[model samples]
Target: MLSWKPFALSVAVLLILFPFVYLVLLSLSSEWRFPDLLPSYFGLKNWATILGSEAGLLESFVSSLLISLSVAIVSTTSGFLISRAVFYHPKKNTLTLLAYFPYILAPVVFAACLSFFFLKMGLFGNITGVIVAQFIIAFPYALLFFSSFWNKKIKSYEDLVATLGGNRWQTFIKVLFPLAKGLILICFFQTFLISWFEYGLTSIIGIGKVQTLTIKVFLFIKEANYYYGALSCCLLIFPPVVLLYLNKRYVFKKLV
Candidate 1:
């Protein structure tokens, strides 16, 4: 007989995974509607149709990927380095606020502030604006995660490097970054997810014209195309899932 502890944990995991599995099933189903209990048939038509529709869904996917990747790299790197500086200084005004605010405030309010300035500058409602907005949103996540890692695992090493013959820049490149590799990976995955699923800010800043996959799903849903909407959702959700998996395996290898 299975113990309740182990069995309950397994059930919980299955429950968590059920939605993703069902989404895949829906994406594979040829046609679906209410009261069927299950689909009449399954095929690749929905996936193929969405990919080949000339509706720019795929373009949106590419755009989201590019922006998210860019944000992940720049935000994580910049945040990680800034984390080192803040940890060393511990009293800088700007860094102090930046370290804490990203988590405390609502994202919509944050987006609003960014969009205001960006729009006045003629940078809003466009790719550049979206990229800039995403960077700001993702920056705090990287900074905080790195701050924790800095305090716990990497500080002594940084100090040792500084004492031995390494300047801060050299130690950051040679020691801090290396020691904080797992934290950096964690931040990258987090930033990527934030950028990819980010609908409101991207949509608000991009308007309707710059429709990423998440925004595309929302548009399709609002237009009442359930099948295509579901397909787009799967598309929007999976890339980050795959990337997160890769980051766990490859980037966070040291942690394991």
Candidate 2:
């Protein structure tokens, strides 16, 4: 018999998707408020305006993209190298844990503490400041993903590589890394998504001048600009959706 569990699971999925459907419909709808069960009309006009306006809206989009990409590359690369160090040398864990544990703190609280230091250093409200701030949030995620393989798999592999005349870097490049490459990509994407959608830390550190989509969406909602608010929310969701789709398309195959 076909299980009831599958049917129950499918309904649950639909319920979760209903809000996204409502948002998409809201973006398309001519007008919708609490009284309405459904939108009065539907059209592409809102999307067209938001995407084609070129009125600093797109600049914000570009800003978010670049910042997320920067966070991803730097955090992932650093985490990968750091994980390699942690893997090959047991002595480094003491100092590494001391440094890395701070990343596990909530971003808002962490950024608040660091913001004071940045203010003293004259670094607040700057793009460089935001990028560097996001690195702290991104690094731990990358470390968690990359470090997993090392805990159980690397020692034997390293010994094997060494016996075969492969040094640490060579073994990393030729052996350990090739195996870990998929995990690294997943880590990069995960970190980029966090940096992309992150609001609390970005807002605290950027101080409203360095606007990301999440910040902008909050601002729009506060002003009661429901159309632009919904529009902004959808746009805020776009990058991660694209990132996930691209990963599923191009990267999932390699991992599987």
Candidate 3:
């Protein structure tokens, strides 16, 4: 009997690599049209143009990096704390359901519903508003991600910490942090990618003022600049890919 694992792994690798190959081709090709198996000409012009000063993409990249890192830190930390509370609460299922509502809903619809409130609060069309909007979606996911940490084993450790005269802060700092550093990293990266790739909420809340990389990609696509769109897509995928590699290689290894 033939095992299916190798066949499945082969298909998975092809699925993952195919789009990336196409994206790289699109980014580098200067004259590859339909029916061409490969481009006759390839250069770094697309990369140079996007990164050059006139494109303002460098600023967009920096903006996205800052916003993603901020969202990751803020959402992950807050979600961890909130998840702890939700885990301990009597109505844990209800609280968890509430947390899932934001994340499970269509982000565009969620943002649209909140846009008026944001305007009323004078938060629309700014970086801060965009961060808050993203946090609403990312925080719920972070909460769910960290919920897995709140099991019987964790409760035992907490009880031990309490018996050792450790307060909540000490238990979290000394015990939970060390035990769950990998999970924290995973949550941070997940939230970071959520904010980094977020388009709808940022679009609605930012109102074109805050130009994230995802927004940049959309604008380029809207303008029919496929090359620049491909470039932006490449930039967008790079960090997450690297982080995933590191997470698999180092972070998860640390967990074990």
Q: Model 2, 21: alpha-carbon shift in Å?
A: 1.4
When 1 and 3 are scored with lDDT, the better candidate is 3
Q: Write the per-residue lDDT of candidate 1 for residues 156-245, one digit (tens) a residue.
A: 776788789889789867876676677777788888888888888877788777788888888988988776787788888787778877
Residue 18 in model 1: lDDT: 93
Best by TM-score: 3
Tell me which of candidates 2 and 3 scores higher on TM-score.
3
Model 1 clashing residue pairs (backbone): none
Local accuracy by lDDT, each model: 0.79, 0.81, 0.90
lDDT of 2 by residue, 70-89 (tens): 99999999988887676557
RMSD of each: 2.8, 2.8, 2.4
1 versus 2: better TM-score goes to: 1
Clashing pairs in 2: none
TM-scores of the models, in the given order? 0.86, 0.85, 0.90
Worst 10 residues of 2 by lDDT: 50-59
Per-residue accuracy of model 3 over 224-252 as CA lDDT, tens digit each = 87877888888898899999999899988
Error of 1 at 242 (Å): 2.3
